[model samples]
Target: MKVSIITVVYNGAEHIRDCIESVLSQTYPDIEYIIIDGKSTDGTVAIVQAYGTKIARFVSEPDKGLYDAMNKGISMATGEVIGLLNADDFYRHDRVITNMVSLIEQTGSDAVYGDMLYVDRDDTQKLKRYWRSGWYSDNAFKWGWMPGHLSFFAKRTLYETCGLFRLDMKSAADYELLLRFIHKHKAKLSYMNEVTIVMRAGGISNSSLKNRLRANREDKLAWELNGLQPYFFTLWLKPLRKIRQYISKPPVKNAHS
Candidate 1:
């Protein structure tokens, strides 16, 4: 199956090259790589343009935000499956896409997701945390469990059926999307027990105490907007669950070390 990998970036000149190179280097030949830029003035567009036609599609324009750019990329995607990779993130290995497609075909599932590693922004080799996404359960969302969004690969039809990311949400849009897809809509999902993406340590939701609190409120609103009620402790458990990520480390050889 063909997979379309979308990278949404804004003024991310520093690391856009790494992200692009990672996608271009994928072992999967049927990948349609798309890059959506928010009219970056920091030479991010130039960096991406330097790749020329190697990038299947490139759009640089002013957008509402990260999720908006993602939406744009999704609308342009023609592949059978779609995956999102952030500008500051890269595939764990060259075969990440190859393995994802293989698993999807083998399991006959609508979606597939795997583990992720958060490495230092300056030194990617230095591990910051390990996000090991275990098997999915119907009630897992109640306990604040979600597969890594970067590692998530789903059919394009899922978005057309379930809907796209909410534009109003600041940080919890990804959380909300996953909740709707896996929980509310009950999309068939398969879990791969391996690391797929390596992300930069800092994330918007966990960037600061204030942002974290805001994200918590948005997360609760996510459930409310979907007409689904989460457990009273669900939001609380979400951040607390990260403790395990910090304590745990990826396997020595398997984590792209």
Candidate 2:
């Protein structure tokens, strides 16, 4: 089955190539790489144009923000499974997608997920934040557990049945979408129990004190919107979960490393 990997970017010339190459290097032959560029002026378009044929669809136009750009990618995706890869992140290895495909097929699950790693700007592994998304549980959402969006792959039908990212919410749209699909809609899912994506430090959500606060407040809103209690508790649990990540060792990468 084909998996559509969407990379939403705007003026990410410095890191876009790494993200693009990660998808292109996936051992899985059936992959639709979609890049949604927000009318970048910083040579991002030029870089993307260099790999025109390798990319399934490349669009450069002004967008509302990250969430809006993601919505556009979702609308354009033509694959059995849809996964999002930030412009500042890359897959853990060439076989990550291949493994996800095999696991999804073997388990017959509607969605699949794996762990993640956090690296420095130079792509040097700084910390391994293993997202231990264990077996399915209805109460997992209550503990504020979510499959990291970076490594999660959901069937396209889930989006059509539930909905795409909420364009109005800034930082918490991914969290909200996860709540709706995994908790509210209760889509069947599988956890791969392995690292899948590597996120570089200094993402927009953690760029500044103000942005971090906004992300936390928006996270509370996600819990409330999903009709879950423990607003403050969940918010705290979200970041606290990363504490385990700081202790784990980084995985070995191939040439893509």
Candidate 3:
């Protein structure tokens, strides 16, 4: 099946090259790679442009915000599966997409996601933390369990059905989207233990304590908006889950396949 991967970037010149190279090197043959840039003045566009015609779609216009740009990419995707990769992140290996697509298709799952590593921004090889996502259950959200958004891949039709990420949310739109899909709509989902994406240390949602609190509010609202109730401690446990990731050792190089 054809898979469309999108990178939503803004002023990411330092990391865009590695992101582009990782996607371009994918062993999966039928892949459509797109970059949705936010009119960066920092020459990030130039680095993406350097790739020339290899990119299927390149949009370098201003958008409302990060999720807005992501929605744009989602609307443009026409492949059977759609995924997002930020400029500061790269796949674990060239066969990452190949393995994910195979598992997702074999199980007839609407979405698939797995583990990821948090690596240093300057040195991608230096691992900071291991985000090993366990299997999903019907009540996984009750315990504040969620798959890494960067590693999440879903069928294009699921977006058409469940709708795109909510723009109203500041940081927790991804969690809300997953809550709607897996918890509300009950999309068939899969979890492979392979370390999929390696992301840099910082991100918008966790940039500050204030941002994290804002994300907490949004996550609480996520369940309420879906007309579902979360456990009283759900929001608290969500952040607590990451503590173990920091304690575990990083996976072996070939553990994925």
Best-performing candidate as measured by lDDT: 1
Off by over 4 Å in 3: 205-211, 255-257
Instruction: List TM-scores for all candidates, in order.
Output: 0.96, 0.90, 0.96
* CA lDDT of each prediction against the hidden true structure: 0.91, 0.83, 0.90
Clashes of each: 0, 0, 0
Model 1, 1-257: lDDT tens per residue? Answer: 78899999999999999999999988789999999999999999999999999999999999999999999999999999999999999988888888888889998999999999999999999999999999998899999899989899999999999999999888889999999999999999999899999999886646578877888999999999999999999998988998899899797545332
The collision pairs in model 1 are none
Model 3 backbone overlap count: 0
- Candidate 1 achieves a global lDDT of 0.91
Q: Is candidate 2 or 3 superior in TM-score?
A: 3
Worst ten in a row by lDDT for model 1:
248-257
Error of 3 at 10 (Å): 0.7
- Give per-residue lDDT, candidate 1, residue 48: 94
List the candidate numbers ranked by lDDT, top first: 1, 3, 2
**Model 2 Cα displacement at 197 (Å)?**
0.3
Cα RMSD to native, each candidate?
1.8, 2.8, 1.4
